[model samples]
Target: MKRRIVMSMFAGATLLASSLLGAAPARSADAPAEFGTDWHDPVTAAPPVAKPSGKSCQVTLAEAQFRDFTPYKGTYTPPEGCGERWSKVVLRMDGKVKGRQFDRLGHLHVGGVEIFRTSTPEPSPDGIEWSVEKDVTRYSDTFRRGQDVEMLIGNVVDDTYTGVIDVKVTLTFYAPSATAARPSATAASPVTNAARPATSTTRSTPTPDPTPDRVLTPDRVLTLQDGTVTTPRNSERIVAEVYATGSGGGCEEFWYLSAPDPAPYSCKAGDGPYREVQIEVDGRLAGIAAPFPHVWTGGWSNPFLWYVTPGPRAFDVKPIEYDLTPFAGLLNDGRPHRVEVSVVGVPEGQSGWSAPVNVLVWQDAKSAHVTGRLTGHKVGELANSSTYTPGSEHRVDTEGRHRLTVGGYVDTSHGRVTTTVSRSLTNTSAHRWTDGENLDALDAAWKDDQSVTVDGRGPARTTRTQRTYTMDGSITIGAGDRLRTVLTLGDRAAVGTTRAGRRIAWSWLDDTVEGDASWTLNVPRDQRHAVGTTSERFRLHGSKGCYDRSLTSVQGVLTEDRRAC
Candidate 1:
């Protein structure tokens, strides 16, 4: 990781003038004949400042095009709660290699701050000591975060490609540095200070540590107690202790076993006035092993204890130097497995063993046959009961006939496990699980099969309700044959277009239909031309969950626009 440089920006006007003056070369007094004349000439000497140097650079992660590579990049749209935001970004640089002289370079720091400068005068024959414009830094400051819209690199040199260069950008979340001697983005003062001489100046401002409590120190071990050991296959024991630290209020300590080989473990010490400690194993509560009443000094000592369990699987615990009988419960069939490890009082949650530990245990391809009732199943749901004779034939008990009857409710949420079936599938009508289908067991099924793979870990579905509608009889208009209209859909029902080809005017029977909900329309009116009558028509288009055809069951004379469209 590259260290970041937090440049504390100073007042600009004075520094700009000073930089311009410093760029001029100095003339020797002996060589100049008119040295005593007007000093306000164009040949005035520039201020002597430290020479700036740099090398090639690269970025770690390719920034999102919306974040870095475009005009609107890095511009944050302030949310409702935000008013004024301040930040100090640290520019980190690393992986520098020597480059040829007089080459223009463009480099960006890890903090996304860019510095592009070029040599004004050509370099000497030795490829060094090239003079450059002091105006670079002054001009660079004008490039605000939101203003930069383009980037171009110029003047490449060969030797500069030696190694890699890394820059780190550390952005202060909401506020600028308070201890900085310059103008901060906080509440500005009425008076501003003048700029100092532009040179290599070190401004040491304190920064807040991101992980203050993460630092841990090992103190004296007051007492080490190996707690009551459990049987070698199951069960576990826990231990607890108390330690005194100068800083109080619930600190965590990581523990590791010292016997055989050192393995790391962790437990918590409580917030103190008086620090109390506790530990648990396999979810079983243990005894307090530290902060005993027998105290000899004013300070406290940390308690130490361990839980001994039988090892895993058929592997045997070798006879060691110490008491092997105490940890017999940990000696089981030797196959590494997941074990829960936790520490109390620390906000950091459980940190289990990084690596699984294998223990010897009895070996067998154990198989269990169990049967349960399939109640509360929906009609047409299937269930199977078959005896598994591994690697042999499967005997279907009662011919594996188990189907949900008319009134029984079936839940696809809790998966239907057909143990005898060769393929795993939610929709049995779909392909087999081995054929690109995601397979899930009982209690691990999704409420809806359409859930995305990532969210399929849980089961839940959307609730659906049915709507009902009924159409009223037709009404008469002018002349022609009377329109024989039948109610296609009831009130409040989403009506689909029953017919197509001819445009018809339709709307909801009432004025309240909206969205893709429901509608009523005009079919065909009568054929009266005494005053030149016009008929209304409704149009229909294909939409989600809707048919493409149109329907105008009854007709009405065009008076004006209907309330529903």
Candidate 2:
């Protein structure tokens, strides 16, 4: 990624003065600042710090050795003074290649939490250096005094290769004063949901009620043998409920195995976090559930502990959820709409990770009343595709109101997903303003729900996930005299499950888990600068088995704690 350079506010004035006086431009009042220390040699032992230069630091490996598929670990600690300066921290990796062969992946961790991951350096031309930088300011709370930091690199090749690669890790910090001019969105206030009891049972198959405006349940179950379904009748508030589970033979298995030539990997089935599921409607893409992991299941195995347990073990089940509400309009036509589920990016025969899916659609008395189609659909590599039809646009002449609703699917590498967006504006001629035009008021809201089922290739090896979000805001323009705006995110939730076979081994529900945010912007008549402030708070609560963890952050401060089930 390329870095952007920002000139100070006085740059224009300084340049103009220098041009008129024919002398060098005078330096601005602000001075340059540096915060962390740097390292200059290989890190083979403790006290990873080399020459400590107050605010900048570095760690080097002169002759790092890595066997194929094996990972190497290194550790470092930031200076205590670097705390609370969240906006000024950056991690950089500079690799100098002595041999032409290098294929690996790099990861950085704080305490025990993984913060960054990247592919190994591409083989560079002789005499050229390869380097990458990452902003670590979001994790400022993890860099407290006396904390242990770990870095791991894995050689991803299938065969062993030996070479010299001079690697340097640098931590750069800037003074607080230097960051004052930058505008930032504030974090949202935290919201917490009560924990549910840990209980396991067979899948719930609820029947739809006959009431016109009540919540409707699925009357049928769709499995691998019954993947397609047609609506029994027309309905409103339609939703396709999906449940999926992942089995063995997944990427997490590939990354952690290390023995017996073709080593057998052992870990809980729900440990692998990157499984993705895609949902298709009537042959068109609908939604996706991407990498909803069971963070609290103790399913994850430590790579550094591979020597202790070297073979495959019996696995358990975990389940995830997905919401297909964006496609409700399309499914309400009382037509036999075909729905298909598949795992994204998992090659056939590589892992026995199969995803078994159960889809249920609910309806009401207003069935067969809604109509829509997938339109202007486009797909590209990874993050480059979009699926959706333009929605209805309405104008109310009496009230001078304009409204629009758009919904559709998006096919990306993560999975094929769906979303719905809406907006409205009201114009009033009640007040006089500075300009000739009448003052107008605007309010808009957008929402999206996405889900997917990932096929792990094995019988019953699958996972499903669902996430929904809503944002609404208001804006007022007073004939160019002053402008005011406020935006709020009302709801955000993600819940998922992983199954081993017929039962749920692990499941989790995270709603806005961290925080919600809102922003307000105001500009006075003839003012040179607009005033803006963002308020935000973050909190995430998750549970698996009898263990639970919650993380909360206010403004820029973060706190994390855990409890046993």
Candidate 3:
């Protein structure tokens, strides 16, 4: 039988959790052939946030339990004695839940800045505990000042769904090292945080970053009002982050498997399953990216597959970032502009997806007003096509791609800086299933390629980021009416920075998770005889450093924990 997993996702004060639980202890003896009350506290192979070994200060951000639809609201004050400057700030959330519940989405806003967005884990009958930490140093500007805070992990508690999400979030600020006042060379320096490769990427030989010369944050964060925002008049660089999620506990949660008009499937989209996250600025196309196909814990018609190990980023959802710098000139005009974010393939008004936008701007400090214009903006026609074939096994083949190029310039205090951005997105998928849908499966992949360049006084600099997301899985019911799920997910990227014609800094990352499980289709919890295996491997190498770690579990017991670099 499955063993009751009593593991803490956190490994002690090693991660700013001075009093948090330690690592998972040795697994208990395997029981009969059934799942247990709780599996391992949800954990991923992703690298933990890096913290400097210096004096640090902590501030309780929010302590609340989510129930119903009401959000926890309060005020946040900067940590005293930590000074206004810090080498790094990390946000950690410790949580516990019992009874039964489905996975839910959540977000945290500080001073109106969206510092964190994540999804909850479906709890076990025996209850469960988990923790997650993120490096939120980039938002130091917003954290240094006191402001209102709001957080929500919307949930419904009743006789059937009886789990309450109890969570506490805190921020730890690490004092700058003795050399923090010293200026050091930055291999990837253009956009201070651009080098970050989302989750699963680690610096092999991370160096303590010096105190930022200029606070590397938006002076003002504006949420779209009817898809519109008024940026700072002297904005030098602008970026928009989309907290996109396809949820609502429905087929839309599996949007990529959606079939077109005639292809019989659970989730159907008139235009097929080609979804793209697109942004328009000032009534013009600005950026386009493929949304990360997120599979929640309660996904794939099977929960047993994820009880021990969620997908690659199930617990830590990273927002999609778009370089809106090329549009800084037009936005700096001091007037409100229509900056809208939309998913291209959703049914006109169907509410399966939720994408809230947060626009961040880097202003030109020396100039009262920066003037410039969009010299060129061009977008290739979006290519989307799908084909359907019916048989014992129905099949739908979908392919789509889009490209965009935008260029502009702004006259700053230092000089005239020209910015150009080019991005391309492609998605392809195959969906197949039997007549009764006893057999359902989908194999899909998405690629987003981008390059941003800045040309001013020194050698022209450019940063290139290439990301790939893949999902391949199948859930089937056969003899004895047993349900089985076998799935694999991949999140990978290659980032490189170049100045003039020389490559200065670069990094490569790959994180993959796989699971397989089966159980009686219509049996009670104890009679299901559920069995499963899950594994994840994460690796990163580059100028930043090198790291490789892997995790594997059978039933609810962790069988392998290995790291190689």
lDDT of each: 0.17, 0.30, 0.73
**Ranking of predictions according to TM-score:** 3, 2, 1
Q: Per-residue lDDT for 74-95 in model 1, tens only?
A: 3222222212222221111111
The sequence of per-residue lDDT tens digits that candidate 3 reaches over residues 183-212 is: 311112334222242323233444211111
Instruction: For candidate 3, give the lDDT.
Output: 0.73
Q: Which has the better lDDT: candidate 1, or candidate 3?
A: 3
For residue 356, model 1's alpha carbon misses the true position, in angstroms, by 61
Q: Give the best candidate by TM-score.
A: 3
lDDT of candidate 2 over 152-263, digit per residue (tens) = 4544333333334445565665435543543211100011111121121111222111111112223332333356555534332234433233322233322211111111
As for candidate 3, its clashing pairs are 1-31, 1-32, 204-545, 204-546, 205-545
TM-score of 1: 0.15
Better of 1 and 2 by lDDT: 2
The better candidate by lDDT, 2 or 3, is 3
Candidate 2 regions exceeding 4 Å error are: 1-225, 249-275, 294-322, 326-335, 366-370, 375-565
- After superposing candidate 3 on the true structure, give the runs of residues whose Cα lies further than 4 Å from its correct spot: 1-32, 181-219
